[model samples]
Target: GHEHSLTGHKQRGTVLLRKMEISVAEADKRTGKNTVNMQETYTVYLIETRPAESVPEGGTPAAPDTLWRRYSEFELLRTYLLVTYPYIIIPPLPEKRAEFVWHKLSADNLDPDFVERRRVGLENFLLRVASHPVLSNDKIVFLFLTEVMNNLEYFIFFPETQIIALKIQTRFISAVFSRRFMGLKHYSDELNTIILQLLRVRARVADRVYGVYKVHGNYGRVFSEWSAIEKEMGDGLQSAGHHMDTYAAAIDDILEEEEHYADQLKEYLFYTDSVRSVCRKHELIQYELEMAAQDLTYKKQQKEELATGAVRIFSLKGMTSKLFGQESQEQREGRIAALEQSIQEGEEAIKEKDAECQEFVQKAWTDIERFKEQKDKDLREALISYAIMQISMCKKGIQVWSNAKECFNKM
Candidate 1:
């Protein structure tokens, strides 16, 4: 899951440290024995170890559980002996571990040189086992060894290999749910386990093979073959995983868009409802104001009619008597003045109300347009961003898939 660039450094470091420790032990042992020279051997071992430390740690960290202290020259010696040990003397019984090793060695389908070496190792190992008194009659050991060798041969001969076989296993899971291969319709737990095991082995071997190829700088037939296998499995695994990731991302984007749109729609609905409510209230207010204006007009008309009637009565009175006519004239003038002032005030009040209504109508139109424009801009930007993101994602996927395909072809 994490980056692994520094892994090479760590492995080389551990190996060198082991070599140093072995040298120290050997030097100490020789010192105690008096016949051995530590000076020449120690310097040679140190020289052999110099370049190992030069390999800097790359990007990855060493495993936490790994015990570097446990690695020693003795361990390396032991491994070398184990590798070559079968040829020297086979155990009383066919060693299960040795069989596993031979299986891996044979699985390479490597050159004749390697094949010949492995054949010699196995034959000698078998001979050693047959020479053992306790293992001479053990048919089970022979059968197991034969099966191991056969599988190794099969693996080597196979044209393609899956690396994620270890992950395809089915266990004691509920029958309601199951995982199956792309073409397979039925479930077989045993087959799944085997698949997963093979994948693990494939991954391990591929890493080692790649390392060797890189170090040797030979990119010919063998490198190409191994690379092809790496590509095949890597693509298969990545494809299976990538599809889900892409789909999930797309779904998330859609949901986010939906939520944003829903929020805007909600706001739009709110404003629309407000506008409708205001319009209804405005209509009601307009109707009431109109009724009030009509009432005021009627009142003014009634007042004017009374004033005219009074003036006519005063004129008739003045015709009958001069003193009474003078007093009635003054009264009529005052009444006319009061009625004009009242009418003027009423007209001014009506004008103010009309101006307020007009302002409100203008504001409502402007606000609606502003909100619509803002929403349009936001939607446009969102769509553009989404389109760009989709394009980028597609490009990335294509590149990854192509790289995987190329790897497989080379392998």
Candidate 2:
């Protein structure tokens, strides 16, 4: 019944932020002594979760469950997801601190604009996790959305046995998909590099655009001042100044919207790391498999030496035997028996590892395909939305200046 309920919720659950509040709290500076040496201001977002099933017609709607979560709590949740699902590209949290910031923009994390953007980013991260077929059904994730826990400490406290089991499972899976995994790694790395370059160029362009918009504000002030000195043309000059001011004010909203698009790009940039993580896991598995195979071969060689009574050239075991005098027939037979047992066990281990590797490759590749499809769809929509926004911004600029031209004609 619990599994059925969880499945139903996973199929239709929705997560959203209703609002955020900023508050100051005393924090220990960790300077050896236990004392609150700093007052830190942080945001607390109000998360709201609606029922999975729709309300019946003419029936009272179910009240959504609500809880407050700090940004640090979000970080904790994301970290757990990253650890638990190394193969899935866990959605990235918003930047904890702004980077590549424009000189004109405030870099303070507490700044209202920055906090608001983070709020949106946090909501998007939760929605992404909630919508994932596999991630959505996670017990911890479900609890996170619906439970009113004060802290997420329990979520991170997995049993040692479970962790070991997970590590072993991942290790086995990674061993068989070397070539394809390497290809995925290379592609992700290249894409990450290109996105970083694009973001850098965008920041520089935004700085210039900011300056250009401020120049229009200056032009507006000049026109308004000139209007004060004019006779018949004064009203027209004042009207033009108002149009210029409106155009100048539009840039802030435009740039803020552009930053949203930039965040979308950064999501993929972070995704590359997750992709490389899978590649690294695969390499580790392959390395483990190779070592096991090599050990088995060495064991077989030992068995051969014991059976044939011949020592391979420059062998340390052979040299030790020669220095200490050869074993008696009984001792020799015991050594051969031990070697034979070890070789048998080694063969069985190799077979098990091979089977595990094959299973892992199949599961991993299937997940990778699903991830690729989601990535393509998301990227296509983001790019198209960005293009449309740019076109709309240009149209607005044209309309503003044209209105100013009409004001001049009226004069």
Candidate 3:
């Protein structure tokens, strides 16, 4: 489909963020199909915008882009962005709207008002994603905003390619034959190298996650030991006829710092596990790639052998078999198309994995910054305050002892 405009403006500069609406009611067969399939209806988000930077003065204002995305799709897009841009904090999705009484799994989720609530949530979600420093520049946000088409049909048929293809493969075929036609080994090698690097980084990321958890654990121990010491000091100060609680106020700051650290540690741990899952997913994809390359190579070799007349022929029956056994152009194209689709899918999968990695690493970096801020700076200041309090308390104790000694001498 061509993006033809009546006003003849094909490409606009930057589409400014203006308004977004969630379209609950629409008269389209696709939306109808969606409603029927899910037994519940979903809404579309209409992103209205005027290209401020791109449009010329007095030029015709183009129509707003119509975008329809399901809640799951919105979730997927958010996850994709999170994976792609690690540092940016993705905006949260709208709460699941219920049309009726609150329940875990209610059909009310599909109600018009409920859907509207969700639409607003999703709109907010997109705006946040677009306004962010790093995420705004990403093409994915643009694609999500501009593309209205649903790929439900594509996903349904895509997995079947593997099943249809597995029948074409029986056992391990020689890389030699396939290499003569299409370069499977090269692609495989390149992928292997890239995946290996990713795997190594993944392992390091896992280690970092574990390391942060250990730091949090060690801090817990520090708090325990500090509490015990504080209690002992409290008893001593009380016995010395001083108010220990006044000096103990400094411990509250320390306690708050520990809480902050604990929260940060939990966030890091979650991302760590998330990145590990992504790595496992990619590892599985790598195996699939190897097997897929084998399948593509098989089709390629048969096509090449038939074209060159390299397939052996001993008798008239054998000749007939050889001629008939030659792969047809259509089948060749299908295999080639399959390989391309597989590659495209792999690339998309990688984009997700890369984003997860960014999320993992960015959290770690941000944690480091927080550590410096909270533990290094704030904690140090708190400790100094505590020390000053201890010094002042000791001075008070010294004065009391001196006065008591003076009284005893007078007695």
TM-score per candidate: 0.29, 0.83, 0.31
Error of 3 at 77 (Å): 0.6
Q: Which stretches of candidate 3 lie over 4 Å from their true place?
A: 1-31, 34-40, 53-62, 86-88, 97-107, 152-411
Error of 3 at 149 (Å): 3.1
Better of 2 and 3 by TM-score: 2
lDDT tens per residue, model 1, 1-411:
011122222343332232221111111111121236334311101101122234346844322211111113222222232222211212211111212231223333233323333333233233333333333344443332222231223322222311122112211212222121111222223333543454345345434533542432332333434434674565544443344344334433333232232222222323332333333334533544575688679658756655656333345554655554444667767766877787887788778767765665565345435434543554355445545654664575576456545655553
Candidate 1 minimal-lDDT segment of 10 residues:
41-50
What is candidate 2's lDDT per residue for 1-411, written digit by digit as tens? 000112322334434221211111211121222127565556677777665454668987576677777777888887678667656667677788876565677888778777776776776677767766677667787677768886798767766754664576454453455778879878888988988987888788888878878998998999999999999999999999999899899888878777777777777787777777667656765766788899999888877878888987578878888899888999989988998888889888888877767766776677688778767776677778778877887787789789999999999
How are the candidates ranked when ordered by TM-score, highest leading?
2, 3, 1
Candidate 1 colliding pairs: 165-195, 165-196, 166-196, 228-411
lDDT of 3 by residue, 240-271 (tens): 32222222333333332322222222222233
TM-score of structure candidate 3: 0.31
Provide the overall lDDT of each model, using Cα atoms, as 2-decimal numbers. Answer: 0.36, 0.72, 0.44
Candidate ordering by lDDT (highest first) = 2, 3, 1
Candidate 2 vs candidate 3: which has greater lDDT?
2
The local lDDT score (0 to 100) that residue 113 gets in candidate 2 is 70
After superposition, the stretches of candidate 1 with alpha carbons farther than 4 Å from their true spots are 1-246, 274-285, 304-342, 361-376, 386-411
Candidate 2 regions with alpha-carbon error over 4 angstroms:
1-39, 58-60, 158-177, 313-316
Cα lDDT for residue 331, model 2?
A: 93
Worst 10 residues of 2 by lDDT: 21-30
lDDT at position 96, candidate 3: 50
